[model samples]
Target: MKPGRPAAGSSHWLFTEDRLREEVTESQPALLPLDAWHRARGGRMVPFAGYEMPVQYEGIMAEHLWTRESAGLFDVSHMGQLVFSGDGADAELEKLLPGDVRALKAGRMRYSLLLNEAGGILDDLMITRLPEGHPFGEAGADDLYMVVNGAVKFDDIGTLREHVADRITINHMEDRALLALQGPKAVDALARLVPGVADLVFMRAGAFDWQGVPLWISRSGYTGEDGFEISLPGDAATVFTDALLEQPEVKPIGLGARDSLRLEAGLPLYGHDLDPEITPVTADLGFALSKRRREERGFAGADHILAERENGAVARRVGLIIDGRQPVREGADVLDGEGSMVGRVTSGGVAPSVGKPIAMAYVPVAMAAPGTAITVSQRGKVHHATVAAMPFVPHRYVRAGA
Candidate 1:
């Protein structure tokens, strides 16, 4: 919708010489197999996450709704996957993050954050221990797999390297392609192509061969569905994605739909919903802090985090379900009963699945409770809204033993 940006559904942008030059030369350090896939599929290539990627294929809205009803394959190869190895790896990582990395089972994963000394979030990440016989080898050798936001990959890598340089080995898996297959029908669709994929529960990961290519598969995603994120060699990513799209239930989704889907799920987008200015407590991500890690007080800004945990944060993130059909977009100001600004919308949109406008924002703790009345100001118009429970669409994660 922005000017100069390629219009939705037009693949003409993919043939621009600048795009080709960037993909072949400028983005060498972060290229993935999906790059070629996008070209072949008429993807409108653009610079994202330090790589040239498809912003949309068929269309954003159509791709978005299709993923909700069926399945959408997202090329998230731009995400940074770093391996940390050495003695006391878990303890070292815990010192930087407020999560109990040591408590994670070998095949399990945990959502966590990297924090600054002042309690600001540096980045949110998913940490998974390498499963037995995987490429990283057993845990004792001081190895851990970390996936971080692609937009901040360079900064994240630099910060990690600066702190743990002498103590561990950090391998950036930029050569790999990360594919997210998400939707209500994701599991069934993937099961037909990759046998045994459906058996894995949420947050569990394992190494498996897909069409003879070794891949790291995890039953996890950002779309609030029972899906999987697969990491494979970059060279084979296009081949693998093509195979997935051939399935009747799977299609390609773009960034616009990705944003809407996650918003419907009440999930936070790093730069928007979370940033260096926002603390994890105020962001409603306090659950990510483990009990042991909280008690140990070893991570950055532990003093502030613990204090907030005990006394409650002054501001808290909450969901807003608007009464009107018109969507309230990001940056909308939230007003209290007195028409005073209480907070600002971080992520907001018309949820296709819910058929209503929904938003997520951080309001003063006193006004964050469910059913609280609020107003959203968008382009000089006031929209009545109510604070609602998160995940406007209930999550379909397949928990262990579920």
Candidate 2:
């Protein structure tokens, strides 16, 4: 499936099935900093998340397999890069997020969510605490770095400005570009440029410089592979990308392969697998809710979120393995035992890594256990599917000290 066809949340290009394409086509899409560079490399550019992004440079199947075996570089610059500074930034952010923001030590990255008053997810994001010496922040100032979905970044910024205390200054770093170098051989390719990055493990981030350009590098990615997400100035995007592509093991990957890779990894896409109607508990993302935050209960919709956690949500997000060779896309209706609709498939595709058609859906708790059989109706055709454990493909992250 084309990445543009799905509901894109920007930074993640969150997936949907059909409406996203229609939404992007209705407006003029902006160009990325690597726009001309992508075109020069034979990238098939498409309108996605209000920007012209490369869907593929080569075929999706080829890129998917290559990344699983070697290394793939993705232009994720369309995602929002936000910096929170001034006094009490961390504590102020904690009020809107369920994660224990105040306890996030410097140079560590945490996966978190921007939630609404009702515990509905506004957007999922990554937050990093930049230490005192990080070039992105003042020499002695610790700053909180956030990367939000590009599709809703402006809205996210507005929400932050409105919700957080005025003392916390939120700077939208629009001049920055983000890149992900993923796969088994990713570390090797990146270490050649910034040797210090080799020391960082999963969920950690640090600042480094290459030929005078400052980079905020993190040992993280969404593809269930050992990878790094690098943030740099937009002006340096073409040069840095070219440098990575020069490595023998690295290849330019498109959003199509990215969508498939994340699907196989069992990571939820914002607009599809997550939305305002879905809380972190129902989406099976309780990990983002820290223990301290749960007890303190200061975040938005804490009452509902905590209650749902204790009593269980009405619906659960579960993985599904569709029967047969034909794959189902998003918006497929999940059916109960008696043929009545019980839920809906949020994300579905042929998982290249798993070599099967896998999907994610919100189903009643009774239908969420693994091995439970469920029926699906797509385009009036009936298809059988079974609940399966997620990350259809095993993850290869380089854990701490590994």
Candidate 3:
């Protein structure tokens, strides 16, 4: 699958079987700050999220396995970096999102969603509380850092501005770039550049300076592996990326391997596995709503979302393991024993780390349990698949310590 397909709430790209190639042919893509850097490193460029990005550097399989074993540097600068600051920062944000914003302590990050009035997911995002001290002067004491998907960032900004602009100051960090260094050796490799980086636990964030450049580093990632996402000045992107590549364990990974890695990790790509039509409950992201928010029902779409939370979702997202090497792409219909349509594949691909064809789909709750047998209809061919436990590859997130 080529890049340039419409991505959902998260930052990863989706490759629809047939529409991608044709759509990108007619689309004009913008270049990233590290565009020339990627081209110089032999990256196969493709249009993605309205920007030209590397889909593969060496190759998807090699990059995916390399990350699982060693470390891989991903250029995810296209994601939106936003800062919200005000006197009532937490309270104001709580009105829009379902997460318990007030509970987020400084240096901690939480995964959350932007919802519509009807309880549909507007977008999924990561919110982190910056430390009390504002080192770079980008934000003040009462500020929060948010990372949203690039494709819908403008729309997300507009929506946020419309609602909270009058009260909170929204700062779009357009001059920043984001990078993810993931895998088993990720910490070992990153610690060499910034010694204190490894000290941060999973989902914790802090500010550090590399030479004179300031970086907002978070010990979290989407690949289900122990990793870090560093937000730095866009001008320093190439320099920092080059420095990381200098480490023997780190290699440049592209969108293709990123997609496959996330698939194996059971993470959903926004436009594919998540959309405006799907609520957090149906998307298997009920945890993002938080305990207090669930009970209070204070966020947008609280009525419908709370109802689904209490009762149940019409359909639930689940993992599928295909029997053969023929990779199942998105839009394939999932069928029951009698060939009745039970669900549809949202994100399907060859999982290099798992060494199998893995996919995610929304299916009837009755058939969503692991070990349930299902069939996938793809391109006039029927293939046997089974509902399996997600994160086909186990997650290796770093806890508080050790």
Top candidate on lDDT is 2
Per-model TM against the reference: 0.89, 0.94, 0.93
Q: Between 1 and 2, whose lDDT is larger?
A: 2
Residue runs of model 3 more than 4 Å from their true location after superposition: 1-27, 135-138
Per-candidate count of clashing residue pairs (backbone under 3 Å):
2, 4, 3
Q: Each model's C-alpha lDDT?
A: 0.79, 0.86, 0.84
Error of 3 at 64 (Å): 0.2
lDDT of 2 by residue, 375-398 (tens): 988778899999999879999998
Compared with the true structure, the alpha-carbon lDDT of candidate 1 equals 0.79
Residue 27 shift from truth in candidate 1, angstroms:
8.8
RMSDs, each prediction? 5.1, 3.7, 3.8
In candidate 1 the C-alpha lDDT for residue 65 amounts to 85
Return the clash pairs for model 1, or none.
85-142, 86-142
The count of backbone overlaps in candidate 2 is 4
Candidate 3 residue-wise lDDT, 53-109, digit = tens: 888877778888999999999989889999888888877788789998889889988
Q: Stretches of candidate 2 above 4 Å error? A: 1-22, 25-27, 137-140
Tens digits of per-residue lDDT, candidate 1, 117-221, equal 888898999998775467643444446899999878779888887776477878887678899999889988888878898889999998888777888899999
